[model samples]
Target: MYRKEFFVFEQGRPVSALIRNYERKDFPELIRIQQECFPPPFPSELWWNREQLDNHVSLFSEGALCVEVNGEIAGSMTGLLIDFHLDSPDHTWEEVTSNGYITNHNPNGNTLYVVDISISPSFRKLGLGKWLMSAMYDLVIYKGLTRLLGGGRMPGYYKYAHKMTPEEYIASLLDGQLKDPVITFLLHCGRTPIRAVANYLEDKDSCNYGTLMEWKNPFHQ
Candidate 1:
């Protein structure tokens, strides 16, 4: 089990936070974080269940991570390894993640595919999400993976969908004309946009579109 302890200030008070591998005991908190992070209209049925959480720790424990702040679960991130082809990177989240079961995780695969990252509503803006992302980058380097990839949501796109196409909206994001809650954050986290994928998820806010993003491991050969 990987473990790291760090401190972040919340309200000018230093709070200790720990990042570690997921345990069966953390399942309920994980589900709660999912519900709090993604509420109604985002699809309640898509929340992580007991079965999928079990599969995560069993199949790829290294990719299942959780962050606790002051003894409370503040955020979590799930990932799976896969043999990604740069030439043909288009795929829905369900097809890539096995509907969140991650049963298809490839131990020898060269890419770490992020399945989800959820932070509790109360934990927002505390840098916990970035710590989780940084930990995944560390995992990629530690495992000799080539890159970290995921289909990032465009939750802020719906506001512009009436005036622009998905492509244009993404372009605007890149050009600094617009900013998407998910895409912008990914960009800030050192990921680059690969392309826009349609029907990537059942997200009304994104109009069922997702931005494929990647962060290459600088140490990988």
Candidate 2:
């Protein structure tokens, strides 16, 4: 699979960039980049307006972060901790979901979900994505929101997978597609793909999307 690079610039100073908390003011720039990347990106007005942001800021505080290139909004990532039930009830799923770069959302349990991750076209392959994700890993661990989980598209789930075995069908259905570049970069850092969800959000090509991933911050474990 292919991966993109990332970078960071602060006050014209070159420095390593990592994932940080999302600010209410970043809505405009974030939505702009979202349009450039995602086919159906979130609306800018949703984040730009203070009223809407006030309601959504808490969901992003744990795993959301952005990159700044020369005082410009180069890229951003958003994640959340939702309650999910993989096997039983009362298990709070902690994950991030729905963002251009990385979607981190946990449906119902304490499991952390990395929904999406992306780098801007102009700033690809600069190590910025990796750095941000590394930081997110730290934050998630520090907060003690372990039991990580996520999903991605697997090649087998595409139109060409008709010949796959029954077992292969199961795996492909769970392992949808590879994470976005930045998310993949994070996986390289330490996150591990655990299980595959039954249903998937297919892409434009009608291929299954999102293979779940998990990670142990070691510091906590």
Candidate 3:
């Protein structure tokens, strides 16, 4: 399985952190991270379930990853391979991720589609998210995929929804007029915005909208 170690500083001290493939033993912690990451009005029912976690590791173990700090699970990322069409990339999270089960994962797909990345509240600002993202990019290159793509949540959109259109809000973000927790983080992680998608998810903060973002593989032909 994929594994790596990192040294992250917390409270002026370095801590041991590890990036590795998810196992059945990590299911409970993964679920807890989901709850902490997406609480209340975010839909508790949408949290990661046992079946989905099982499907993820069983179907594509390489895409299901977790990060541990001081031997405790800090965060995780799940992905599935798919043949994405840049010409027609408009799709909801459910459609692209098979309703979060990722049962439709294609081993021969040309793209690594990130299904979800959830980091625990306690681990925020420690650069764990970026580490997880970097691991995924490495997986893309190792598999010779064309790109790493996903529908990035626009959690900050709700604050300005009554005053701006989704497109305008995204434009402001791209223009450095506003910052989003998710979109901004993805941008800093080397992803480029493709477009804004409506009805992409059930997130109230995002007003059910998502931003389509992608990171191209320079080594791909």
Prediction RMSDs, each to the true structure: 1.3, 7.4, 1.3
Local lDDT at 152 for model 2: 48
lDDT of each residue in 68-183, candidate 2, tens digit only = 66566667654556554556321112223343222343334454555455567667656566666665666566567655445544543454345754235544433754334323
TM-score of 2: 0.63
Considering only N, C-alpha and C atoms within 3 Å, which residue pairs clash in candidate 3? Answer: none
On lDDT, who's better, 1 or 3? 3
Best by lDDT: 3
Candidate 1's error at 165, in angstroms? 2.6
lDDT (C-alpha, whole model) for all candidates: 0.93, 0.51, 0.95
| Total clashing pairs for each candidate | 0, 56, 0
TM-score for each candidate, following the candidate numbering: 0.96, 0.63, 0.96
Residue ranges of candidate 2 with Cα displaced over 4 Å: 1-19, 39-54, 83-109, 155-159, 165-187, 204-206
- Tens digit of lDDT per residue, candidate 3, span 27-110? 999999999988897778889999999999999999999999999999999999999997898999999999999999999999
Candidate 3 TM-score to native: 0.96
lDDT of 1 by residue, 1-221 (tens): 78999998999999999999989999999999999887986778888999999999999999999999999999999999999998997899999999999999999998999999999989887999889999999999999999999999999989988989888998998999887788999988999988899999988889999999999999988
- Error (Å) of candidate 1 at residue 181 is 0.9
Give the least accurate 10-residue stretch of model 3, judged by summed lDDT: 37-46
Against the hidden true structure, what lDDT does model 3 obtain?
0.95
